[model samples]
Target chain A: MTGPISGPDELSKREQKALESLLFRLADDEFVLAERYTEWQIYAPTLESDLALANIAQDEFGHARLWYDLLGELGYTEPDLIWERPPEQWQHSTLVELSFPDGGWADTIVRGYLYDTAEQLRLEALADSSYLPLADRIEKVLLEERYHRQHAGNWLERLASGEGHDRVVAAVERLFPHAMSLFAPGPHEDNITEFGFRSESLQELRRAWLDTVIPTLDSLSVPAPEPAEVVRPDATGRDGSHTDDWFELYDAFTHTYTELENPTPVRLRGEGA
Target chain B: MIWEVFRQEKKGDYHKHCGNVHAPDREMALMFAEIQHARRMHANSLWVVPQAEIAEVDAEEASFGGTTDKAFRWAMTYNDIDASFAQEVADSEKEQEKAAKTREAQI
Candidate 1:
């Protein structure tokens, strides 16, 4: 029988690498997606929805900061880890990197619903992680994700019940495949699973996600994507292969950092600088 | 909907104002507040009040100012209590003692 899993300090070499990769994927995906969400800060259909999206974006950014801090403790400078990396070096899932088409409010809701469902699944699984620090962080993240899931579910219900329901359903159908690809096994997936960093495999977590989401989608009269079609993308994100949008996203996100004369600070500044 | 959340760090402690969260209703507000505030610490309990239900009284109102002097009600106004009140208390105690002795002798 397997022994009781220990905390971050007790992590094995393989486990540490796997955890680092997972953290990178989690943090980068949220950070980049938050920028996209922020684009709708003033453009949402309703003021309340706009505020909700912005709030969620801020929460995601905070989560990224937390993960980045973890990465720093594991021997990586935050700026070098986030800003200096090229687009191809990023490990964010393709679902988050996809450009939200100017397809109006329906498209936005569908995208939000898809991303939230996937995030909820990943976070729930991570909550049982062997690493104490990761498990604790995931628990905190899961709390916020509950609201995000509810908000997305509410919008999905509204769109499915109201006019243009068919259009929204079609949009979701088109996006579901990409959403499934969010769980594509990373380069260190085998090591992560074997080392007990996560209690479940990538495929196992994806299956669990589908079990919950497919039923909900069916209830909403939206068709779910087939499991076979939900495997790795033509450009696998786990292998550092990403779409063209990733380059644009990376450039835009790191523009300020790249333009700075001294991107990394060597000494302390004012009180909170 | 806006919820104002007050959180208590431990049992028997007073709940202090933490922050606000926007939700569709009270249930969602509580859920969001639990996540936003209490997730990081040892919060024992939370009190959530709807933003609309909160009543505010302006302390800056000019009409509510006190018009009369009520200085006599304040202890600070009766200065030199050791000199004035102490003698009065001693005299009163002596009178009470004399009355008690006369009553005892009559009995």
Candidate 2:
């Protein structure tokens, strides 16, 4: 609220908390969704789909790194932010943490469709954020998100028709509730907007998401539930609360890193190479 | 339909022709291209074009890099000038020498 807080060092204690909330939501969503997407890698319906999902997963992981790097500017190491962070402290939505059903190709399509649409809206809202670093990073994330949305939308249309109809519907019905968590406000949401971190309210983003998703699903001949008909999960996921699947996933992913005991962060690119 | 794939390893880089993939449409072609050409290789972007649409001028049809000697166009042709005095001219001569070696090797 007090002018453009350009750097993390300039932030007051409360402003820092607000920024962390936003960054964690952005980073964890991308990281967890990417992990789920990787589950479909070799198991995707076809070889091409496998590659497409793998590429999408990589794109998301890269996006996550971008946000996590921003968090690193606040003095948190990679292990503190991710590897050694407690499972419940991860702020990713339950939708991403939910495991795909056995051989459920339809699950990946519908999940990507719902998530990418919301992601697009969310990023568009963040494009003009007063927080300079946050705004600066939007373009890179948005460019890659375009391909992801296109990939998901293409599959969504094809899979929503003919013999695949029932499965797509089933997946949507199962995942839609958790997708609601995409806009669930964290404890610092008020500070986030008050500090000009994002222009759109979570309620506004949620409405925009619903308006976009429901109509798209309806056009695909998949009946979307009324917002009133859906039940929100007990865990908001924005407040560091999560589903059991999140705990299991956290354990699985961090196991190797933990067992190693020495967490010398692995660097794939940039100056670290 | 067959589509030729081009892979760009980084932003602002030229896309080099990689290989072709069997696909029914442009979308599917791109999907297949990512796997076929970009799976193991690094890619910032990929382009897929219909094989039939790409114009070609091979050695058997119209000679590539020209059949007749165009020695005057090469940087090495001007041997009177000391190209080493200028880094750019020296680099150009080195590139031309490599190209000449490649041409001779082909023959």
Candidate 3:
């Protein structure tokens, strides 16, 4: 049997572009979501919840780092890929970039549950990818994602039964539209699947995401939005288009790097326990 | 019978001594440990050992590390050399520094 696609050289020109686009999508979504998750650091309702979210954010950043390192293999430096890149060039779903409303713990739970369900499906599809490098990284990410989903799911169920049930419903109503953007395909969607980068189609993933999230949410009395009312056609975050919040978020995150004019971002290099 | 309990707070974390539990057998020991040692605190895994099975040596019985001034074994011995160039060395230095402080506290 032939070995998996280990390096850039093994891919055809189209396959390489497809792989690059896929990596950018994965890395950008994870990095942006993690950046937003950090905003809850000291603000979460409880100490244990705060630590849990922070740990999840760190896991997402680590996953993003793995994807970005692969991009490095394809010739982009870290700065070129992130710190120095224009805000408009990022390819993440707009759902991840939105800010959490103050005291809106419900917002965080709903958003996390929706986003993580989608992420789980996406990772599963990539688990058997023809691109060996991408496939190899999925298991590590998937292991951590298990906790994230359970965390979100548990919080969602508990919060739905409490005095904050109204807030949770409002969060569902407000965030469902943007959550759809997770399934919004980038231009290379077909190329990615055609080249064996992801074995499942985006539509299939979207369908699976719906099947998993909608019923549980419905059971919790959280209504999923009608498809027509929440159609966010402009949220093709996969194609580099994003909401105004993304650029603002991007600038804030890169502010330190730009201010210091540092030669490179500090990498703890797995040394920090 | 008393069971000595070791609790690990999270995956990849060290299994540290917490508290002990009293149970009749291994299964009961584990169940008791789960409630007494792990219920309130976050725990990834737990280990239990019978108090009878554990062996201990007190300071009066033996001098730990031979009470030697063997400063050569510590990374801080060569204070002039920079450990920054290598991560493993830096990590070792930090660990040794922590150990030194603990030993100082004990004394």
Candidate 4:
């Protein structure tokens, strides 16, 4: 009642598929990207960075859970929905699924920088979505992501000015191609836009991201990557094609959950048995 | 070091336990507490106490007769509060007033 009561009456056939695609993109992107970020949990250059990354990972996983819960309400079982998906069936952007190659602090910083900027645009648009549930979810997600954006911005400033400037610049150049691919078109993007689920097209969001990120990189004296001639992929993630990194991520994240044969007993906080 | 933060939601309200924050000093603790607890615009003000400065008591050590009886201290003890309860309270007040008067006279 506080905001607009502009949500759909009930999801139509096209609307349902659009919403499902949106949720899959958002949920899979965050879940998979958070898995990659967790690899830096103990290896970050600074303790504060480690804690910040861990917090970001937690928020991403939390966002994924909220999306998964929404999916469950739509009548999909959670485990089957998440674990049953093949790598090629995931809808996460290629940017999120890219590997950082263990290139040390610079790679992590650059990855966080690019992903946070892109995610901010995507999430801000989703925050205004006509879907009430998705809008509400974005409200909570944006709060945490604001911190992630700030963390990335702060590091971008520091690394771009400090002795590690060249290293960060190099990493940016290497990753920007895949980062731009986050906007690769999916089959349902036009329907999603037409339904008012998102206000902007993928190109528009990418432009907005560049507008926001380029100036900051400029201020930090970090050179931005040149825009590629051909940004589309014949077989890219937005169209459900993923790299081997997706399998790596799926394996890492689902390790513990897959190990149990039967339902595990819940353990109380201080209980030994 | 860890600092325990207590937040007052409005003016003149008692500070309630919000959460703990880790910081090296009072300044950092204040910064973290402001962001962690107060960023949502709910907190009016906050008090941060170093974790080490807090004194804690366990309820188990302070139990009275395993909770068998402490009815005299509770309002429910006077379940039948028609006339006798008022009379009893009046008598107690009178006794206290008399005792105070006697002490004053001695003084």
Candidate 5:
């Protein structure tokens, strides 16, 4: 592996852009995914599950903060990183931005399963990232991710039996294609690889993700349609193109920001004004 | 014929296996435990159980947690998430970080 890039100041102009691209992709996906998960907080099937899922959402937001913190070191403000950024500029995968249908427990579990599986593989690949800060933060993210996987896996398995099986199958059919966007490359895909920001390519992580998830779902009799047969949505968020759902989510989350005339994003952890 | 004592030093604190006392029965065990285990220990509580009632699971018979890595359960795993924002989360993480190190040392 290449030696760590040391610090943001040490980065060349090309390297700086490449790092921002990777960080934005990572941060955006986590922030948006956590936002979706919070939607299930009080609505979960049981009180215990509600608490568990809420804690998981908090973990995701914490992870997003980790990536965003790195970006902050590069001189980006919190508002620019999220609240004030235009919806069209977000780089999260489309899968995270989609709203869960009402009472759609199956959809949430399936989406989480697909996403967490990819997340586990992706984080493993970044464990030895050439960027010291990213590498340093990998262990904590991986630790929390392990719980997210177990939580999703438990729900997926529970739903895959008897009557619950059909709903899971339908959810898979509807969501598997969107989940594929988790591996979709961003604008700095080439530079990220060349600069060793990540140790593995997205394609390799995708293959490993599929190898683990497809069979796990199959064993549970949850139908994951063949890769070639699934048609991807036109809005691949990596290219900054997102579905209408995303715009709605952006407006909803930024509601207070807009009405309050863009108050500074609150920093609950670490140093803040 | 034998009694086991567990002592909790304070409210909300965990009861630990301090030491056992030899006694004839549960009542006697409690009395003996109070004098032998709790005396001078600054205990908030004490528990006494028959040695026979406690089931044994040694290292040879079972793994406490799986031998595989389970760093996820520890608060230290989320290194970048500053726990100082919430006192309890930070406290839990600090405790877990210590436990994790102790666990690592044992292995």
Candidate 6:
């Protein structure tokens, strides 16, 4: 068993690099996905659903904040990590960067279901992380993620019973390949695993995710792409390459900070504030 | 009879009033509450009590926590004393902060 790493100074160069790689993936994925979720703020199917989705978006942002704050312990500022950073430097899965089709509520719920299931599995893997900061925050993040999974699963079941079924199916088919990128390892996978940053390997998390999600989707009558048939997208977003949509989103989100000549990003208190 | 349903979302969590269900009796009220209020939500357990059994004292009946300021009871009143040194103290301060806002809204 690995001992608790109290802070950045405790890590070697290789360990630091591995931690950075892991942090970038976790932070970027949540930040981008939350940005996408904000698009449905007023445009969701109903006011109640709108509020629910908006809360989920805020939860994702809060989770991102936790990861980004961990990175700060290594001497990086928020501007250096986000607003002022180049779009290509981001290491999120392309799954989050893809734009939602207009009024595609089905895509929102289905994407959430896919992401949350994978998130639960991966967070569980990090529950006993030797990195003290990471292990400390996992429980709170996991608690919030449970609500997200329940929200998505509730929507998926309700939608599948009505005219929304076809839309959900289309979303599943169109996005499955991209969603698989969630478990695709970064270059520091071996270091991340060997250092006990995460107790389970990405391959194990991926298999567990598939086992849980496949049957859940099947039960809803929404056909998921078979595990063997999932091909990684050309731009997986883990390698610093992303689709054009990511650049567009990056520009929009950072427009204010870029134009102001001040790189400070605004912050609000409370988890969902 | 109308029976109000309160849902405990998870273990150790407080039960909150969700909504009321129409039923002929207490037993049927619980059965209806399970389907209506607890069906779609993540509820660990639920309680259904007859609406009439709940006594209420509205604003017109009684004033709550008094109309005068009771700032001395608040942790924030002694803001110079740092609560940050202890997590429990900080948590209590936060709860008091929320309670203060809620009391203000009530007044």
Pick out the ten consecutive residues of candidate 3 chain A with the lowest summed lDDT: A264-273
How would you encode candidate 1's per-residue C-alpha lDDT over A97-154 as one tens digit per residue? Answer: 7777775677777777877877877777677776667777887777777777787777
The runs of at least 3 residues in candidate 1 whose Cα sits more than 4 Å from the true structure, single-residue gaps closed, are A1-12, A230-232, A265-273, B1-107
Q: Residue B64's C-alpha lDDT in candidate 2?
A: 66
lDDT per residue as tens, model 4, A1-273: 023324445777788788788888888878888888888877876554566677778778888888877777678875666765556788887767767676567877788888888888998888777778888878778878887777676666667778889988888776777777778777888888888888778899989988987787788787776565534444467778777777787776666667764244353332354
TM-score of only chain B in every candidate structure: 0.68, 0.58, 0.62, 0.62, 0.58, 0.62
lDDT for each candidate structure: 0.76, 0.87, 0.85, 0.76, 0.85, 0.86
Candidate 5 lDDT over A1-273, as tens digits, reads 346887887888888898899999889999999999899888987554565667778888999999999999999888888889999999999999999888888888898999989888888877877888889999988977887777787678778875678889988988888889988898888889888998789888888988998899889977777887779899889989999999999999999999999877676757864
Per candidate, native contacts kept equal: 0.00, 0.25, 0.00, 0.00, 0.00, 0.00
Per candidate, the number of residue pairs that clash is 0, 1, 0, 0, 1, 0
For model 1, the docking class works out as incorrect
lDDT of each residue in A119-207, candidate 2, tens digit only? 99999988888778999999988988888888888778877866889999999999999999888888899999898889899999999
lDDT of 6 by residue, B1-107 (tens): 78899999999999999888776556556655665666446889999999999999999989876999887787775667865679988799999999999999999
| Pairs in steric clash, model 1 | none
Clashing pairs in model 5?
A: A140-B77
Worst 10 residues of 6 chain A by lDDT: A263-272
DockQ, 0 to 1 scale, candidate 6 = 0.02
Give the DockQ (2 decimals) of all models: 0.08, 0.18, 0.02, 0.06, 0.01, 0.02
Candidate 6 Cα errors over 4 Å, as ranges: A269-273, B1-107
Cα error, candidate 1, residue A24 (Å): 1.3
Tell me, what's the RMSD of every candidate?
A: 6.3, 13.3, 19.2, 11.0, 22.7, 19.0
- Quality of candidate 4's docking, in CAPRI categories? incorrect
TM-score for the B chain of model 3: 0.62
Better of 3 and 4 by DockQ: 4
DockQ of model 5, rounded to 2 decimals: 0.01
Error of 4 at A8 (Å): 8.8
At residue A179, candidate 5 shows an lDDT of 88
